[model samples]
Target: MSSIAIKFGIGKSTVSDIVKSKAKLEEFQTEIDDGDCTKKPRVVRKSDFPELDRAVYLWFVHQRCKGTPISGPLLSAKALQLYPRLYPDNPADFKAGTGWLRRFKDRHGVRCLSLQGESLSAAMMDVEPFREKFLKLVEEQGLTRHQMFNCDESGLYWKLMPNKTLVTSREKEAKAFKKPKDRVTIMACANASGSIKLPLLFIHKALNPRCFKHIDKNDLPVHYYAQKSSWMDSYIFKEWFLNRFVPLCRNALREKGLPERALLVLDNSPAHPDIVSNIYRWIDNMSLLATQHYIRYPTHGSGCS
Candidate 1:
């Protein structure tokens, strides 16, 4: 080893390892009865200990589903936490470190990903289908660009994004959302002609918050409503449509000097009470309003962003 190391200008330990590699490399090659051992196949295993890795993966998925905050270091710490409990025989002798973490991530295909729930890719596939339906509806209703209106309810975090919004696949934990966050639901209605914009409804959990102590409620940017969870429901939707939306449309059309005939595009959901069950009642009530509009329902997330 010393002679080989001096001649190759390498360390004696490296020369010894090189000499030992010949048998190890040969062992990795295929052995056939035909005396041919040319192939060297790459093998994939779940982990050095696949059964233990499987348990870890299951635990990871369960915790993630519960919206637990997880990071690389956190996962490594967890592995250490579970090592003794999982392997009772010589548990303290187990090696759970960067090597295990790296292999575990690769095996499970878990990555640190920033997941935003918007940008519904599944909806994009139906854009062409929606266009054809939209055109057919417009022709049936005899509606123009000035008469076309859109209303959508969106979820927002006034303070910061919620930690539950972040998601990941496989045996790793999701990254927690940073910053303080308070959720708010907002509903808005506007015309394509940009002439009419009805009062935007901002849903809050509290009827009166400490933050609004100084600001006048009458001069607020949006019409405020309160609910236990600050969410829109069938009752609120009916009131907005019959009492608020109907009057706003009539006034807006009158201001623009356009005919009181328009289409109200709705954000549709199959399970929703307002857009599904109580929609017929709303349509019947529209006859009393000065503005005669038809309800144009688009599937959940199928509407234009």
Candidate 2:
């Protein structure tokens, strides 16, 4: 062993360790493909529950192929669920906790990443032409940073529960409860310069929820409204535009000693009405005191930066 270590330009202890692990190295060589024998890893750790590990890894791969997201807790839960079925007669005490999950991921060479959706899709789309056109329009209209604004709405699950939880050793399974579906819609508007932010328009299913029964709706921080679906609609948006938006914008401009003339950027949502395509006609009928121009921005693109 000493002669072999000297020939390989290594320490004698290293050769001794390799000699001790000869059986394991042979086992690894047999497990991998013939072509991959030359690409063997330096270290190979065996799983405590081999069948369970394999089953979990196969299940994870199947889910990922179907575009299903797998969280750490979800993976752990699935492992715990499958263990009993895999070993009905065995008395193995398996708790697929965080430590076990870490090792499992290392064994399978798995990585956790954020799911890509609309934002990533939008990034891939060509928005440069739209940006150039928008810049040109801004320059032609003599619009300042403070005079350009953008508005958008989003849904909120107010009473959503956490995806994970903790349980005692005495309790083998975590308690399950009906997930809440309580929701609301919120709309926000702000200028490019960040000089002004209008009051949020909050929409709920109830005109006066039980929590706000004793309080006046007008006194609330948000400009509250009620709709059956708790979603933004044409009527609600029109009301917000004519009543809330115009007056607030006029006041804001007055305070800044600027003309009550500005441009509003919006998306092509059904709720925004037909003003985007024919804003001049709509503005004429509304007979507003201030001049307001509306621009229909691409929905896939983000808000004005």
Per-model root-mean-square deviation over C-alphas? 12.3, 10.5
1-305: candidate 1 lDDT, tens digit per residue: 77888988999888777567766545434232223222324333336665677677778878777645467777777777777777778676767788888767765656675544443324565567766767876786676777777777887888875446545566377666568657889988888888788889888899889999987876887878788888887777766766677777767776877666667666453213434321222343332211212234332321110
Off by more than 4 A, model 1: 1-129, 161-179, 211-216, 270-305
* Candidate 1, residue 254: how far the Cα is off, in Å: 1.3
Candidates in order have lDDT scores of 0.65, 0.75
Predicted candidate 2 versus true structure: per-residue lDDT over 112-158, tens digit per residue:
66554454334333466657766776786676877777888988998
Where does candidate 2 stray beyond 4 Å? 1-109, 114-117, 123-126, 168-171, 277-305
The candidate that achieves the highest TM-score relative to the unseen native structure: 2
